[model samples]
Target: MSDTTQMETGRFALNSLKMLLVVGILTLVANSIGPETGFRAGFVESIPGMGLIVLIGLVALLLGRAIPLDLPAFAYAMIIAFALALPFSPVQGPFLGYVERVDFLATTTPILAYAGLSIGLQTGRMKEVSWKLVVVAVFVFFGTYFGSALIAQAVLSAQGLI
Candidate 1:
């Protein structure tokens, strides 16, 4: 379309790529410093897995922008990741092999930190909301936590793993 619109689109894409790269690096560092392995060993071993994860995120971001729907980029990423990891999928073997190198806790660490920072920054706005909303959010969080624990316990018991 217009030259200005094209320039803005290019700028947006470049910024998105930069943000994703930062996230990838942060995630790699988190994974590297985990308790199970030394930093050098973990960092070297997890490079391929982390790279694939970031690539999937980049593809999902592009897909989200290209599609007309209002779905978020993370939703697209989840779908693509899930599909790749499915047992019957063609890429399942290599996908799982690479993905398994990255610990689950490593990924959640950065995400949780970001979420906490976001909430901290929004505290002023949160104060403007009703107390009832805070109460509801507490209950929702509690229920989700308890429900997940119960499900995990049941599954572990059924599998004779606990």
Candidate 2:
């Protein structure tokens, strides 16, 4: 590879690391001050869990870049995280305990905000798309939501939790 290309790659990796650290800090703050009283774990207490999450995300990003396929980093991250947290995995106990300390909603807030901002910035591109695409997106989102709710209800009922 050319020197310029290598330099750019190094810069990109550094930027990604910085972004992941910022996200970890944001998630820690959000988790510490979330609306739910039960989720008020102090910021200091949540550092290890959040750091682990960021490290996993960084590993996933690197893996995605190393692999030739077009799959996104989050996909690889999910697979890796799931493997580590599986019941039979050697790291399952500590992994789950630390991860569970990080509230799910806290992690999603920044991601959703980023998604919204990106979509907002692309409104002109979105307008260029056929209206049918919007309709399809709505239906897909609705179907996903309904399916998730149904599955949640069934699971809760089975467990006598609802």
Candidate 3:
């Protein structure tokens, strides 16, 4: 195989390993607490989402490394997005709303950051440094947040799960 192909493969492997480590650690923690929490329904329901987020985050990490983009820029964008989504994420009642919100943030943040990082790193100059880009990024972040919510709602509606 060519050098580029080999490098890509190596990077993918490394990223996958990192993701596995993270997931393993998280799972251990969850398992440790599950018995203590009574292990009834709540813990069972939330683990899959947590796993999904970890999987997505791993993919995003690999993609980010493969691309020539700024990691910090991507992180900044995600942080901004998380801030916007926080207030709207339902965190109340008996359900583990806080855990769900955290999972949602985990799933979305990496993707958003990857996007922003790709743009910021590839472009000759960051319009990102300017106030306009910040405003635009914020809007885009909110757009994604709300758009995901709508899509999720539609899916739930179709499934009669809403």
TM-score between candidate 2 and the true structure: 0.73
Best by lDDT: 2
Better of 1 and 2 by lDDT: 2
- Across 50-131, the per-residue lDDT of candidate 1 in tens digits comes to 8898888888887777787888889999999999999899999998888887877788888999999889878889879999
Candidate 3 residue spans exceeding 4 A from truth: 1-7, 10-18, 21-43, 72-162
Candidate 3 residues 66-146, lDDT tens each? 656556434643544354356555532222332342333333444565579788766766543888877998999999999
> Candidate 1 — number of clashing residue pairs?
0
The best-first sequence of candidates by TM-score reads 2, 1, 3
Q: Each candidate's TM vs. the true structure?
A: 0.71, 0.73, 0.33
Candidate 2 lDDT over residue span 8-125, tens digit each: 5567678889999998998888888787655446788778888898889988988777786888889999999999988899999988877778888898888888899888778888
Relative to the true structure, how large is the alpha-carbon lDDT of every model? 0.83, 0.84, 0.55
Ranking the candidates on lDDT from highest down gives 2, 1, 3
Clashing pairs in 3: none
- Among all windows of ten consecutive residues in candidate 3, which has the lowest summed lDDT? 92-101
Clash count list over all predictions: 0, 0, 0
